[model samples]
Target chain A: MAVNDAGAKQVATYWEGMVNSGLADTKAYGTTDFYNGLGSGKYVTYLAAGWGPGYLASVAKTTSGKWRAAPLPQWTAGGNVQGDWGGSSFAVTDQAKNPEVATKVAMDIYGAKNTDAWKIGIDEAYLFPTATPVLESDAFLKKKYDFFGGQTVNDIFVPAYKTISPFSWSPFNSYNFNQLTTGINGAIEKKTSWTAALDTAQANISQYATQQGFKVQ
Target chain B: MTQVETRSATAPAVAGPAPRFKRGREAATGWLFVLPFVILLVAFLLLPMAYAFKLSLYRSTLIEGEHFALFENYTQAFKDPLVRQGVVRVVLFGLVQTPVMIGIALLAALLIDHATSRFSRFFRLAAFVPYAVPVVIGTLMWGFLYSQDTGPLSSILHVDFLSSNVVLASLGNVVTWQWAGYNMIVLYAALQGLPREVYESARIDGAGPSQIAWRIKTPMISSAIILATLFTILGTLQFFTEPLILQPLNPGSITQHYTPNVYAFNQAFSFQQYNYSAAISFLLGAVVFVGSYIFLFATRKRSAL
Candidate 1:
């Protein structure tokens, strides 16, 4: 099951592996939908990503099986490249009452010393913490799990955190990004040249930036 | 008898030549009645416009502060290619989207008015439901539907509707979807207001529905159609929300200056070029006013014929 296909391969590989392992009879007890199957009690162990962790945790609790949390699977074992599937941040408004206290609490929860606690809290709250210290700490790093064939999940996060960069947000970021992506995706779906679409997008973005008085490089 | 009549007139006029002061009091009452509206106009509309005009005359950054530059901001705005592009995009949107929207609205109104279809109320309401939805929400929904992976339409059709080459058309589809029904309702009301006797007479004279529609109904409601077209033109010129929402899903296709309003927004907020943004806005307003006047003039000419 190649990840590149992004369709049927993972499911096909799972079923084939189950049959080879004398677990064919167990298939009837589980739904083929992987997302739904994760909730079913048929599987004793499951590997999951950082997204929707809270709902996953609840599902794990409901199933009559033991479950554990781990970092995302790398395309290759110990790969340096990592991607963020989803995450959010918290910021205090200027007009908020007790902003100083709010900032203190935020820093304490998301700051350096309590990295392990933060990770644990995020898992409990069904969120992924963005703090690098928490992601690389001993509590997260030393964990060995049987679900992913005993691969160390913490290794993936350390590399992912190092490779990650902060996203630049602007009022027009959403607007510019949408138009550019829409054009690219449209071209991709239409089986047209993706480069041409991207080129045009670049031109458009530059034109727009210049018009808005942004000194584009 | 003459003496009695003179006395009666004199008695009635005893309060007579009711003071010249009373006329002045009536004039004051008139002013009192209009005072609230006058005060509001000055406070809200006139004050803001004056402030905006003042802002346009200065080179300013929101955070860094402003300095008077006379026409420097306007000059820079005019010189900027991106501003030119924004202006062009808005003009193109108006030219393309306005007629198409109004045409569809007129067609729908005519069909609903003449067709013997059942459940017309249901259709009318369904057509108008898009107007009930907020533009931001509607655009976001359309954005999702335009998504490559999860959108129902994309999945079913197996086409990338948001692609760069086709995005302008895609945007047009969204704007038209939201506005066409609204325009239709306006035109439909106008159609309803047409005297039934005219239609009956035409029918008695053996006139076909198409002839009646083309020759009589359309001509009579030409004013409504023209009004709808003008409204659509103004709305198209100010289009911001749909493109803004769609930009996120596909950044490569849209840019900060895709439309004039967006261009101005980015100028003031993103680039901290408040003066330039102000100038552009004023210029845009002027363009809209002139364009509307031209359209109205043409409409009047047609109506006169």
Candidate 2:
């Protein structure tokens, strides 16, 4: 929770209210467990990755047509909100016998020229190619699923990805996650205030990053 | 000439010495017999340890290729808060879990050792079966049993067994159940090795079964108990599998840095910080070595008695 920034501070206040209202510790649930919980109506909303809906559908078959993808809520009215989760990038390593050929092959997989076809080849369940042309094409944008009541899911996500706040990862992201969760656990257990937890996490992460020879801010 | 001939006749005859070439060939054959094990150990264990140590001395990253940082990674590992906390948490876990586990094991070993019935063998096998189960499988089974939804524990106790507050105890229970039998087998073997005459003498001296167990058998087998304790301590400090498998079921309680080894593992694989991970691992190894030494030293006099 942010203490200095007014925008973040406001969101933090709202988050505190949610916690006070008995926001169950979501970390206790694994992917499958959470999916089961969702299907059982144990949770109202779940903030998830771009691929979350398709995954939910496969796991929670009985919950078809019940759930919908919506843009995340904003701290202030008319403000935009978006976040990114896990993803991998393709690269041609130095060990490649022909780097140019490797680069070309990598490019073709997600390139604008052939990405749409590749998505089709993968049966479209493996969704969300990051190629601009593929994303804007009718095939991708107009795709609908029975899971979300036949809504075009990308219509909600595409615009959301555009206004997402720019974020960078530190080399110590794993260590950062570990400390962050520990602080979160403390807050969830009611052993400490969320603000204190965040402060501690920030101090610990900065120290950790510095020790790892990173240019910590 | 007569005296010399008599001395030569009196001297014992000796067989010719083994051929030098044959001895050399025999030595080579012996080495050949052990060659497979030696190669495997060096390839798997020794080589990896050497490489890990070398990696620990360098800092590798996407931006800077790889550069030797000397002891920089080790220093960073020493300073890392997560490493410190994880080590401390495991030490606490070891302190509590090791004693209880060993106590249960000693009791079981004593009971089985003294039993005259045919069921003793069955009971011994039953006690040891949990240890035979793979750690991941055992932990997962325990995870299911601890589940609030499907497990009977929550309904019976009206409390969440896998919740943040009680998850550690739940994990401890799993470890104790799995390993107490293992330590019991070791202690039980030692009990079997004890001379029967001591117990017979104790019986003649009006010593009851319980008395003989505590005053005679227990003290004689103190060394085996210490060995069990040492292993338990090391195992506890290096605790990873149970928590890791259970993490998915209860992440809030068991974070990535739940134990030192887990922290090191996450760092190396998840974060791709192999150098730092190696450093953390060596630090943990150092702790384990020193801890074991101190324990053995502390118990030296008692075991001597």
Candidate 3:
């Protein structure tokens, strides 16, 4: 995504088009209240995390048994691709009285070992485990999501994860996100060319990154 | 030495600056009385301000830890268009909202001060009710009211108050509603302090209520008005809580950079760019100081005229 061959201007132009054509509304998902509208079938499509199915079923019960999982679309049709929305990880602090035990406990919840059990335990909590072995396990594969029209969503997600290009998370991720979102909103509101908006955002983010002691390319 | 000490003690129980021990006890008592407030002010206000100033001079990051950046962060603030835009936005807000709010407050005060004014108590309480509402709750309430999908106001009036085109004005309206009464009270108190004989003399001279309000009463309370305006300007520059609460519900229009305070907050807390955040805050404080000076100067010139 960072090295998009179409160039940054084109990416912005495409986003502007999406906004203009009503393909996407940047304002829609600014908050979790969007789920209320989504549950009532106000939107046809949305980017979802692993727990999205369970969430949709519980919150947007009206759409239950109608939803299904599918591979995220590639930038170019049939191009090898994957993208992630959001995920979380766990860490142990130095202040922990028993670092070894703390590490073990954190791993038991988040690690690949016994992922099937972890997944089942957090079913109501609505989490998708990131364990490869458990994802491919028979128990995990056999379980059905009636809300997602009885599809094995994990199978699709597990394969999708393999195709995703490895990317590094920057220490300045929040600033970057702010710049992009703010720029996009301003552009949308003013009905200006997205290229200008994106260019401004890029310049600001790069400058800020440099000012914050990050190595800027 | 013992004989000299005994003679000195015998000669002066009430002499020699009340004895060193007595002086020390008195000083200790005074310090003890002021200790709590001094500690609180230093801990909560003075120390944090000093820390922020210190942080403003450095650039801290995960890769480099903390490094001396000197005025580089402040320089970046100067160059940043978002910071510039945010300042301009708030200045405009102050320009519009301050006068409008003061005007409404002044009018309400004058009306309430009039002998013929009806429902004075009711009007006074009604005007103040919004001011009593907590800013976050008030903003959130207004957010719901401004909602295009569910808010009754949008459906009834057929207008989206949260739309980018009118959102600033909508915020001005909210601010005016919240502050007009408070300022009204200030002006009202000033008005009450005026000599009754002045109004009587004005009445004798055939000056009508409106004429007296405009010609006599207003000029008399000019100082209070200026004070209120200064407060309003200061308040507007530091605008944060209201817009922040409304931002989540009114996305695309309300960004993290919507206000200078918000921008600084996002930089420090969200981006972990504490140095840059500190720089932004100091710069904002500088702006406020300059703005207040300009305002005071203008008011002084007007009074001279």
Candidate 4:
């Protein structure tokens, strides 16, 4: 809920400054040229998800072993701030003919019940399940990817995922994200400062939150 | 809703005061022919429009709950700086982009019509190939060409096409590129329909190809040009696709409320403001309709003129 009040100002300022100083690529990544740019060394690092290896491996075959993973530097040195992406949930639709059976299947597929489902998920797609037991398991920890020179990269991700600062997710995430992007982009264009952008986002999101019938300070 | 019922509903209107018995068969047959289209139109466009209109009159929120808000959403939409900015942008875009596109199409059509070379055939197809490419794909291609790191032509063109200041013109350029060829084909078809005797008469008066093209062919194709202009204006008024496609590439330049259509989508999907979204969409529809109407009415003239 906090925008300008949070360290968002710091994060926004840092990246926005990087872009304005020409220290960052203005071009968006995840494009066709992105992979080629990687091979050409246009990028030194890619801020990718924990499950990025499967996708990265297919596109970045030429630079397979050269890749390395590292934690994002904290704004506050030794700060525990961390986040994740691509979190998903399963649901049984109300219209499902066998809702009860569908529910059980959904629960068991990646739920706490069995290792087989998760084992297949990891082997196939590099899915990072939220199961603490799975995270602590030796097989999960030992699994190595040739892309990162067989580094047990989840060792980096698991701790980071575990200590991800507790926060209530805004129901209006899409609006918040859109405003954030707009602000960040404006800052990148040097039309506004990063802190100014955060301030704008703060006002915009707060107003929008109030409109959605939520009390905001 | 069915054939018999639809025919019955249509019967009184098509019936005449003096000639009811004689023309009833002919009118009934005509109505029957149009029945399928009427059914489809009612099923799709009108019903959805009515529902959206109903939604626009109400407000629904987590705290406020659902209630009749009358014209509150419409009033808000009108006053919304986002909506106003988007409208002003599109109108400006329409004023510039539409004319340029139509002129290019007209010129291209005239030249292709005049040329008697086999290469003209190739040129015609080449011009039309952009039209064949979908808008989404064409914008993507342009996005690549405008990319600083990877675009092949960006440096050579000497324009930072994706920069916020230049992005509207860049979008205009893309739209003009997309539609010019299609409009050219339409105008060319209209040009082809003109009698060859008109050209013969003009040439007999010592009018050269340029004179014939300007004095003879151009005026003759004004109807087609107007039609093309109308379509382009409507297209521009509802401009969404290129901006939507290009937004991610240049998020700094393109905001969520970059265009009215895009704003409606953001409201409905992002903010869960369905009522506001409906209001925005309906207001945009009014703009498109009223804008096109004014153009037509302002330009309305006797066919002979």
Q: Find the candidate with the highest TM-score and give its number.
A: 4
The lDDT values for all models are 0.69, 0.79, 0.80, 0.84
lDDT of 1 by residue, B1-305 (tens): 47545644654456356766555655655676789999999999999888888989986532335577899878877898888888888788788888888889888888899975777777888899999999999988887677665567877988767665778889999999999999999999999999999999999999999989888899899988888888888887877888877765655456667888888887777656667788998988888899888889877855432
Cα RMSDs, all models:
11.1, 6.9, 5.4, 3.9
Using DockQ, give the best candidate's number. Answer: 4
First chain of candidate 4, TM-score: 0.85
> Judged by lDDT, which candidate is best?
4
DockQ of each two-chain model:
0.08, 0.26, 0.42, 0.58
lDDT (Cα, tens digit) per residue for candidate 3, span A1-217: 2322356667678778888998886555544446656766777776776666666778788888777888776678888666677876567999999999999987877777855566664565556655666656666666687788888887777677677787887666776787777777777777887777777777877776775566778
lDDT of 1: 0.69
lDDT of 2 by residue, B138-242 (tens): 988888777776666776988877766787788899999899999999999989899999999999999999999999999989999998999999999999999
Ranking by DockQ: 4, 3, 2, 1
Worst 10 residues of 1 chain B by lDDT: B4-13
iRMSD computed for candidate 1: 11.3
CAPRI docking class of candidate 4:
medium
Ranking by TM-score: 4, 3, 2, 1
Error of 2 at A177 (Å): 4.8
> If the candidates were sorted by their lDDT against the true structure, best first, what order would they fall in?
4, 3, 2, 1
After the best TM-score superposition of candidate 1, give how far the Cα of residue B231 lies from its true spot, in angstroms: 0.6
* Residue lDDT tens for model 2, A1-217: 2222455446545666777787843436454456558778777677767677766777778878888888888767997867788754456789999999888987877677885565783245656666777767777677787888999887887777777778877555676676766676657655457666667777876655665456754
